[model samples]
Target: MAVSGGIAAYKSAELVRLLRKQGAKVRVVMTRSAMQFVSPLTFQALSGNPVHSELLDADEENSMGHINLVRWADVLVIAPATANTLAKCSHGLADDLLSTLYLAATCPVYVAPAMNQAMWHKTVTQENIQKLKSHGVIIIGPEQGDQACGETGFGRMSEPLAICNRLMDETPTRCLSGLKVLISAGPTREPLDPVRYITNRSSGKMGYALANAALKAGAKVTLVSGPVMLSPPVNADLISVETAAQMHAAIIGKAPAHDIYIGAAAVADYSPMITEQGKIKKQDDQTTLTLTLQKTRDILAEVAQLVNRPFTVGFAAETHDLEQYAKDKLTRKNLDMIAANWVGRDLGGFDSEQNALQVFWKNGQKNLAMTDKNQLAEQLISLIAERREYERGNKNTA
Candidate 1:
């Protein structure tokens, strides 16, 4: 573990403890400035190893310390990676011990950034992050929440447990291996005219995250996505669609072949019954214009009612009565599960980077706390896998 200089450095102590509790052999590497927030003795005692703090220690340097350290590591994790450290890494500045190790290390590098919300949102910092990711660095998070700076935004380090789990490879188990997953994502456009269309604020982040999570769990993933600015996961087969009808058709054609179906799209419930071929002209004295509407296809309900249906999941983004609406949707659609969240809130759901879920099944539910969509997706996928396995086991016993 490499600790950088940031207020979040304090969290590294708990992170080290979690890593050790998971049976990992840990070593402490602190930058010169990191020693300000936390004492080196604290980490050394927890890790039960000598703390490496200098690039010019005669004893360690004579033994080719940096190169040796790089060779000895299976993975190098940087928690509380400050903006300065990120900048140094992106530009390949080896002026400091941690940056030097980052440059020399052949092992996988995982960085968890921590800084003020404004600093995190700076264009330069975002560009630096892109550069690091381009070099195969696995960026864990700077999750959105209360920061030490008394501001709430996207500059806090992830929880110690989450970081520790990744370090120990304790999560993201490949339990869904050999299964095929079909998912729909984004907001389907309902056209009003040639130039105008109605769509929701769905950003497709959640669905894309789920698709990626399923792929990581060794599932063959097919993603049917609506128009969105996000890139598709490289491992998943992506089929792009515009309108809700197109998405419905795409899913119906592929749903039979998959073992799981997750309808994550915020598909338009109603489309204009009559779409004008050209842009509607402005009238000289028009006060109101109305258009008839027709219900779009119920993709989830259709798939759930199939004679040989897959394990079906639906998503509900509600503004009020969240639980009631979600449970009602689950029963009405005959779905195996439904993940619901309240949209139009400051915290999560609908084009936000974070989300919480109230997942409902027949007789039980799980409330997932708000966090990064990626992490939430992993948790949701794991739960679905477990539920599916239990159902299979019950059938066998019966």
Candidate 2:
């Protein structure tokens, strides 16, 4: 599956052939503009199957074409996913054929974005990518290099072969077999009313990265998420919430049933106690919008306090003084460990795929340097595996 208006949309035919050569089924779905770059007949000949491009085709719906196409796949991958396509998938805004399939797909979804360096760097685009990850959508790459648009930086589609290999590789690992995990992600919206709210810029990237990595490791993952404009990850059970209160209710509802819990959501620390019924009109004088903010329930802390709590982890996105804050959170929140990073920098941790980490635990500390979030996420999960094992042993001995 490929989205529209991307220069790299032309490479998808070769992608189809490579998959067929590996003895896997091949199907293609393209957006309207993608047809402008390449013909559906080209892909149909390559895959030996009809190419799908529309959601509203009366002929196909009569035969249940989209549902049939959706059920036919072990995985759906979007190569050269345009930012616009990414946005639709991120927030359940499925206004196109590919987006509709993404919403309707029961299998794993992978997106390889391609665009100019500048468009990729825009905060909106990056945040949309994070939202998709939070939804269990595995992001491949927009590798940094020279582009077809004569610009250079971080906006190239991962080579088709690389995307195909990585998709196939998900079947081998059973790293987290028999492990049940609970994860929370995104920024909790603290609502003043149905129309207004307070929230953060947490695009939910780190948590989603961890969730995808956990799945690749063979864990049964449950994601309790906030108001992120992203799609649900493929194969993950998703619980959606808006406010911190709602997030708390969802977490408390499920925390006891899992073997591990990672509270990665940036829950709003405070919320407005009173809200105007309608839009507050402008005032000439300095009108202090006295939002009587109240503290939100501490999700990780509550989990840590449980009688037989699962291994708990937390994330701290800081702007300065990383070491102190990370260590403090480790002890204060009583997390097994915490991952901290200095946000608001150009190193690309927040809305960017590449991220760095300063992890703190009672036993030791480690500096996880800047790398692709997917790679870093795998490393983080490995560490969690060891930590979880050690804690289990310690509990049994006690």
Q: Which candidate is the best by lDDT?
A: 1
Q: What 10-residue stretch in candidate 1 is worst by lDDT?
A: 166-175
Question: Which segments of candidate 1 are over 4 A away from where they belong?
Answer: 1-109, 112-122, 127-166
Candidate 1 lDDT over residue span 1-398, tens digit each: 89999889999999989888888788888997899999999999899989998876678747567777777876789998999999999888999789998988655578999999999999999999976754446688889999877899999999899898776673356778899999999999999999999898999989988987787677999999999887677568999999999999999999999999999999999999999999998898998898899999899999999988999999999889999999999999999999999988786988787899999999999999998787788899999999999888988999
Q: What is the TM-score of each candidate against the true structure?
A: 0.68, 0.64
What's the alpha carbon RMSD for model 2?
Answer: 6.5
- Most accurate candidate by TM-score: 1
TM-score of 1: 0.68
The window of 10 residues in a row where model 2 has the poorest summed lDDT is 168-177
